[model samples]
Target: MRVVVVGGGIAGVSAAWAFAAEPDGRPRGGVSVTLVEAEATLAHHTTGRSAAQLIENYGAQALRPLTTTSLPFFHEPPEGLTDAPLLTERALLTVGTVEQDEAIERTLAEGRLANPTITEIDGDEARRRAPLLAPTDGHRYVLEPESADIDVAGLHQAFVRGFRAAGGTIATVTRLDAARANGSGWRVETTTGPIDADIVVNAAGAWGDVVATAAGVEPVGLTPLRRTAFMVRSPWDHESAGWPLVADAEHTWYLKPDGAQFLCSPADETPSAPMDAKPEELDVAIAIERINSHTTLDIRTVASSWAGLRTFSPDRSMVLGPDPDHPGFVWCVGQGGTGIQTAPGAARCCASMALGEPLDERIDPGGLTVDRFR
Candidate 1:
């Protein structure tokens, strides 16, 4: 079967790779996959603009398996695919004030359900892990030492390489203007030209609903939330790169070590649509204030700033599997900030549904099924 995967983010690329993989000598043949990206380059949107984190316990319960399933790929990756390791040691620290103790405990409890490696760390220990954190920022903290920093670019490139090596085609600068159900497949018109496929995978981050509408499928309530991130030169002269990622208990702001600098985010999720995103000055200033107040690292000036959309479903969980009303029109959007970490498993799931194969044993397709959203 021929599959046309929409959106060239990590999910789209991974799906194409999975679909193009050689089948296990079964009667069914491997699929021919074509990946479409609106931009001139793939991953030029949210995938390229991520903070590059891999927190296993992050996101909703249904999505955690995607992260867990993706860990192996991040650690060892497919051979001959990437020159550099995709993941490096990094911790995640969630701090809270005394008044916010209940919230912290609740979060830790939820995290333990998916991440057994997480543990409660006292204030002093938290400070030791992230010396930049101020002593007064919070009274308690939870630490997930197993969390790692993912090489977003490397992962994205690996998928692209794997897909192409498996004979998958990628069409960049191809914006889908319309799509229609034709016989047993779809006829899609893009900037480049027309294409027909047995399945149309909707991995279009912020433009997911737009694609659905064009395909004559009922649009799901996929809301794109804008998340702003900026880089600032680390205040310390020493190698201040190994510090763990720190975030407020309320999920208000976060800062993490990025090379010799730090990447800070206000953790804001403003509703938006697919477009060339830009950082808001007010948002950046707000993040600066939050980080400066909570850390000893005097972050006065931003080295660079950018924003990306984190699309979400109404329930905030990913919408995977086939659309309930249109099985051929697969739904793979609503990843929000978990896209990079969940790409591997998400792609596998998408491929499973696309090829009519059993879902990967590593992933629990129950909660991630598109029927839930309906």
Candidate 2:
């Protein structure tokens, strides 16, 4: 079978790799895979502009298993896929003020259910973990010690390497124009030309619905939400390196240490179109204000900033597997903000469902499949 995966982001590459190779990284017979990217490069959008951290307690309950299933791959990736490890030790710290005590407790309960390592700590301990946090009274904090910083580029490259090694083809600068059913397969029209495929996987990120519409499939109500992030110089220098990723319990703002700088975001989720996202000055200013009010960093200037779209299904869960009506049209979009951390298991599940194979025991997608939306 010839499988054509649209989009070259982490989701697309991982899905293509899974379709072409076995879990142990050996090439799979009787199947061919091709990955097509709209831009000249892969991961030019959301995948490239991510605040790359893996927090197991994040995302919806139905989607958390995907993160859990991906842990093994991050810890010990396929031998020849990458030279360095894809994950580095880091932790997540979520804080709330006295007024948000209920919110903190709710979050803590939910977090503990997903990851037992998640624990609540006092304000003083929170400040010790993230020294920049202000010494506010009645502050509540939850810590996820198993969280880590992901090597976003390295992980993407690993999938690319595995796909290539399995004899998969990748076509950069090739955008899918449309697709139509042809007998038992599909005639995929692209910017460069046309190709025939037995299956067409829609992993177009923010353009998921657009791709589906172009293929004459019913839209799945995917909303692309914009998230702004910027970098500021870290005042503590090396001391900030050990600090955990700190965020407001309500997710109004977040800060992560990166080398000599700190990556900060407003955690804004404004509706957006499927296009190249740009950071808004107002959003950055809001982030600075919130970060300053909550921490001692008092951010004054932004070294750099960018935005990315985190598309989501109406239910806020991923839309994976083959569409109910269009069995050959696979859906690998609507990752929301968990795409990077869940790529491995999500890709494997997508491929398994697409090829009529059983899912891995560890991955429990629950109600987050394509049929759920249908």
TM-scores for all candidates?
0.95, 0.98
Tens-digit lDDT track of model 1 for 296-343:
878878899999999988877788878777778898898988999999
Give the per-residue lDDT digits (tens) of candidate 2, residues 1-374: 99999999999999999999998899999999999999999999899999999988888778888898899999989878999989998999988888888888988898888889899988888888889998887788899998999999999999999999999999999999999988888999999999999999999999999999999999899999999999999999877988999998889999999998999999999999999999999999999999999989988889999999999999888989888888889999989999999999999999998888998776665666777765
lDDT of 1: 0.85
User: How many clashing pairs does model 1 include?
Assistant: 0
